[model samples]
Target: MIAQDIVIRPIITEKSMQDITKKKYVFEVAKKATKIDVARAVEELFKGAKVQKVNTVHVRGRLKRQGRFEGYTRSWKKAYVQLTADSKPIEFFEGMM
Candidate 1:
C-alpha cells in the first residue's frame, strides 16, 4: 500500500500525548498494513523524521446495546512509532501541544 494509504491519521489522546515526550507517536493505520509499512509511512509523511521502532495493536470492536438492539463498533489497528534520537520530532504534533 502507498504511504498515505497505509497510515490513516494520528491518534491524539491523553495517553498518546504523554508518549510524545519520549519521541513516540501513535497513529490509526490500515488493518492490513504491517509494522514495516507503518514505519515507512510515518517517515515519508513526516519529513526529517526517522522511525527506530514500530509497535502495532489490533483493537477488536466492542459490542454496544441500545434498548433491545445490539451491534459492534468498527475494528481497527493502531501503530506506535518511535523515532530515532537524533531525528527531529513531528512538527504536526508539536503544534498541537
Candidate 2:
C-alpha cells in the first residue's frame, strides 16, 4: 500500500495530545499496516520528521446501545510513532498544542 494509505489519520485526544511533547504521535493506521509500514509512512508524509521507533496496537470494537438497538464500533489499528531526538516536530500537530 502507498504511504498515504498506510497511515490513515491522526488520533487527536486528551491523552494523545500529552504525548506530543515527548516526540510521540498517535495515528489511526490501516488494519493491515505493520510497524515498519507505519514508520516509513510517517517519515514520508511529514517532511523532516525522522521516525525512531513504532509501536502498534489493535483496538477491538466496543459495544454500544441506543434504546433497543445495539452495535459495535469498527475495530482498527493504532500506531505510536516516536521521532528521533534531532528530528523536527510534525508541523501539522504543532498548531494543535
Candidate 3:
C-alpha cells in the first residue's frame, strides 16, 4: 500500500500528547499494514524524521446500543512510532499543541 494509505491519520489524545515529549507519535494505520510498513510510511510522510521503532495495537470494535437497535463500531489498527534521538519531531503534531 502507499504511504498515505498505510497511515490514515494521526491519533491526537491526551495520552498520545504525553508521548510526544518522548519523541513518540501515534497514528491510525491500515489493519493490513505491518510494523515495517508503518515505519516506512511515517518516514516517507514526515520529512526529517527517522523511525526507530514501531508498535501496533488492534483495537476491537465496541458494541453500542441506540434504544432497541444495537451495532458495533468499526475496528481499526493503531501504530506507535518512535523517532530517533537526533530526528526532528513531526511538525503536524507540534501545531496541535
Number of colliding residue pairs in model 1: 0
After best superposition, candidate 2 residue 81: deviation in angstroms?
0.4
Score candidate 2 by lDDT.
Answer: 0.95
Q: Could you tell me the TM-score of candidate 3?
A: 0.98
Alpha-carbon lDDT, every model: 0.94, 0.95, 0.95
TM-score of each: 0.96, 0.97, 0.98
Number of clashing residue pairs, candidate 2: 0
Question: Candidate 2, residues 1-97: lDDT per residue as tens digits?
Answer: 9999999899999999999999999999999988998999898999999999999999999999999999999999999999999999998899999
The Cα error of candidate 2 at residue 79, in Å, is 0.3
**RMSD versus native structure for model 3:** 0.6
| TM-score computed on alpha carbons, candidate 2 | 0.97
lDDT, residue 24, model 1: 95
Q: Candidate 3 lDDT, tens digit per residue, 1-97?
A: 9999999999989999998989999999999999999999899999999999999999999999999999999999999999999999999999988
Ranking by TM-score: 3, 2, 1
